[model samples]
Target: MFKSFNIRKKIYYLSDTIKRKNVSNHLKEINFILNNPESNKSKIIQKSNLNNILNHATNTTPFYKKFRNFDSILDFPVIKKLVIQDNFNEFQSYPHKDKNNFKVSTSGSTGVPFFLFQDEVKRNRNKADVLHFLKRSNYEVGHRLFYLGVRLNQKFSLKSLIQNVSLIDISKLTDKAIEDFLEKVAKDKNSNKILLGHVSAFETILKYLDRKNKDITNIKLNSIITNSEHLSVETKTKLENYFNTPALSRYSSEEAGIIAHQTIDSPDTFVVNHASYYIEVLNLNNNTPVKPGEIGRIVLTDLFNYAMPLIRYDTGDIAKTKVCDNGSIQFESVEGRKMDLVYDTQGNVLSSYVFNKIIYKHYKKIKQYQFIQQDKKEYEIKLNLQEDKFPFEKELISEVKEDFGKDANVNITYVNEIPPLASGKRRKVINNYNKNNSLINPALSKHESIT
Candidate 1:
């Protein structure tokens, strides 16, 4: 029932896909040049192309031109959520087209759910990257499986009908749908195929699968391709151990199709997609280039996207840069969203994912809690209790101290409720640390105040 698109449509889809795949391969060569000091001529070509593209966009697009005078990428001025939200039209390099292409909005997990348009070139690049990463894990493209969040809405949309004929719904990850999903996964032969979805949804599904004593590891499936969320080492291990397939992490965003990716040579690290775009790891505060092995914010310049030029755009992700022995740029880790890092009293930089585990471990007595760190030695843990749970609180403090340190002075404040943000996501932690400095604030203390 599920067949490929008709000849004309399939041709349309494939041509763009080929362009993007070609772009991705080109990027690899460019990255090879950038990583090697001896490939000086390649660097010159890349730099020249970048400058020309930036100049063209600046002269042609009103909003994009503002960054031209900026001496350093850091000086380009950060694009806050409000700026992008309000000035989307100015961000577009090409004139808005009719609905010949696709448009989707960001989920706004970071308080910015703005709509972005994707032409065939952008869409195909994305698909190619996913397919390429999957192939690395020995997965073939013809494998049968269910895909989450890939929809072509138009009712009785041609694409929808095609999916209905071929794809089975194991159910989406929701309170109402999860039980059915587990049952379907267990019974369906397609479960032995690749299960592709967002990392968070996949993780939640794995938990339920593990609890039911269903040995998914026995399933003859390829590896999992997880994107659009922070995939931690712990999460990766849990998924691989449970599913018995490698979990390949993909680094991408809407602005740029495929910025970086993991492959056989660098499984733990995301190599920059040097063919289609250029990547820079610079100090978030000052925008200066960070040395290898140093953590910094990620900035990218899309070389091929003349539609909406993203040149030296601050992507709001914190990561460490590494140069492999083979001389390639490796994105060691994506440390949550750029503004999402939490600091402890001892100035330890902790990712929110790290704390999520601690919270889930103590999920029994804790109704809800918000973590706020004011200074190097002070922290406030505000929580809503199902019962008094005072004993658990003391134990939590002790555990946190052990996990963090004795130097950390933590306060457990019991509250009625911890409010969800406007975007409908629960922001369980907030750190009012200095954005100007890459380091955590040593002077932060409890009295620093909470709004």
Candidate 2:
């Protein structure tokens, strides 16, 4: 099966480049220092490694050359996704040999599809983040389940074949095929593995569970891990109700494996990977640190990636910080996305989190729902729910009206299934309202919001 094949492929990839110094060695070296944090040697190791990364990025990468006069960390300008996308090759340590590197393109779900080169060190750090997150979530690396996504490598190639356990292509979100795939996962015995994918893909599955009135509590699962897309509390509660498992939200990107993750012990707040990367929650007006517990934009400086350094890079999402009494950082909550917001003509901004909370509170029979803002103050609600309770659609409509206010136009539509975006993350709320003026302030980019 693919489990073994993936292992074999990794072995082969390593064998082919053994003389070039495998990524595993670097990981082991860094992990040793991270694990033994109490040792004085930790500081020595970290400073030495970071200095080397900075010098390498400055000397080899074209973009960094312009920053030769960079004085302090604050003096370095924020790197936007667009800037990186346009000059990806120039950002590389070996720009001319970009194709020779392991080039990987993102799913482009959030409207940015671009390629990134992953060197051995970056790859190992990425893997470490994933493994560390899985450990925190009470799951292992090789848990059994149908992994969903488009196969990147060739179909017959050993790499491609190994990546193909339960691969489902989801370029289109609204599809019967996607529903069928979910049904299989729900029924398959071999899938005690946690259901994992973008928020959109899992939303589709959750909708199916709601519509059929299926007892997801009966389904076997270790935990439900949501990534790529925002994990709204509404979706989290619905997923937990059906699957009878704790739903953990993970914040990650293709460029970085695990930025923040919810541990099995602490399902609420996401702990930053402080050892791997330095995370800062900055004010939108200035890159100053936000007051404790205040909402701000999430910026990152990846301490690991040397081929391309990201100093104070904007991640395009908003988050609030909550430092525990013990001084550990955790997120109080992450708004669905900075761009995903709805507003009314009167200028009252409705948060996706608010919609999700209201719906979950009022309608228990409702399975999965999506809120679409067609215009200021106009909206449509879509649902996929149980058969016997299908008649309860009217009640749900009334509930939305009650929560959104009486004047808000609300329409209820029934669909067999709901699909996710190309990135496989399901968008719970789609705002078509003009960006310039809305009941709420327009969503600011991570960097834009934070200065």
Candidate 3:
């Protein structure tokens, strides 16, 4: 009657063992935090990890050595990606050791690149964190994943075979390729499959299906996770409608791994990766913690990344957040990048969601789009249409003028296809004018609507 050694658990343990990554303890610790988030054990583990990392970072690295006297994360300065670039060598754990250490890099949506050194413990913990989040999204240890990517030239490998991950390249997603992929999943109806990739790739698939009037209600996917780009609420509904399954948004980054994930029941609020990251939502102007439900900068203290030891690293992301009594961090919504934030003609602050609204309103006509604010009153829109005829060009211009200003110079250009960035993400909003990271607008109030 005591069935502790299940097949799934056996596979999980054996797989980790095969890789020589003893992540059982790490995974257990993560589960403990998730289940007993408000428990004393959870608080102690979080606090201890924070203190240990700070202590380790200060003791080992020259960069953090100055902050050695300061124990709390709040005492340290919140650093940006640029700060890491300037002090790359100083951040690494010195003494010319740690053979298990490795390097990782990311050229994010803004085309800005940053790198980090990760130790074996941090790598294993990241693996465990990803697994923990995926498990919450109906993913088991054995389910095959239909991965979407861009410009990735993948080949046959032992890991791919063992993991059952069919990496489909989205650099050029042909209709035939999509149909065949859907057929493969539908072919194995009982075996629950998973789909994970960029939000844009999923949109392309949906657009194709809609164009062809195809039905794929029999795919029987365990979960559909859109990541690597902003996953809008409207698009999530469309994906779920067609796939007939729970479509969730996975908010992750190259810097930290899985940050937060939306649950099936709570689609708006994301369940934070409390297992690995001690998250803080701070105001834009002031680097202090923001109140729950208020939008702020997502600064993370990586409890697991001991190699580089990132203390109070500003993630360059904005989000409305909530912290439950049990020490769980939930994001109401992960808004777009801090730089991608747009503005009105007179330089009034605008919610990035305004662009999403325009895209949603014109989904039927526009295949792909990019909004660029060139000058204070000059705006440009590049559109790849679903069809040749766009009869509402003037209406679109008028609508944009309403936001940018009635006398604003707004131009619209039709394109064959809006090309994805080098990072494979289609940046929907780009403010080329300036970077006003401050939440306060001296022109008027802190924020203003399109009206």
Best by lDDT: 3
lDDT (CA) per prediction = 0.61, 0.65, 0.78
By TM-score, who's the top model here? Answer: 3
Tens digits of per-residue lDDT for model 3, 1-451:
1122244456667888897897877889998997677788988998888888888889999888987888467667777788788888888878534566878888756656778888888888888887777788887665677888876759887566555667888877788877877787789533757899988888888888888899787677888988888888889899989988888988888878888888665566898877788888877656666888787878888987777888778787889887766566689889968777778977776767786776577886788999988778888889998789888889888888877689889999889977777778888888877653443422222221101
> How displaced is residue 129 in candidate 2, in Å?
1.7
Candidate 2 Cα outliers beyond 4 Å, as residue runs: 1-50, 95-99, 150-192, 215-219, 342-351, 361-419, 431-434, 437-451
Could you arrange the candidates by lDDT from highest to lowest? Answer: 3, 2, 1
Backbone atom clashes (below 3 Å) for every candidate: 8, 12, 0
lDDT of 2 by residue, 25-139 (tens): 5555545654554466766776666566666667788877766665555555666678888777677886424434456677765567766666666776676666566656666
Q: What tens digits encode model 1's per-residue C-alpha lDDT throughout 1-451?
A: 4343244335434654575446445435544554453466767767776776677677666777766775544444434445655777777765534435567566566656766565555565565555555556555444445555433232454544432223423323553466665455556554335666666566556555554556553355566667776676777887788767677777887656667766655678886766566677766455567898777878777675556666666676778888777665678877757666776566666766666667666654565667776665666788887576557767778777776678788888988876544322355666655343446321223212010
Q: For each candidate, what TM-score against the reference?
A: 0.72, 0.74, 0.91
| Model 2: worst 10 consecutive residues (lDDT sum) | 442-451
Q: Which ten residues in a row have the lowest lDDT in candidate 3?
A: 442-451
Q: Model 2: what TM-score?
A: 0.74
CA deviation > 4 Å runs, candidate 1? 1-49, 64-89, 94-104, 116-120, 149-179, 186-192, 346-348, 353-392, 402-429, 432-451
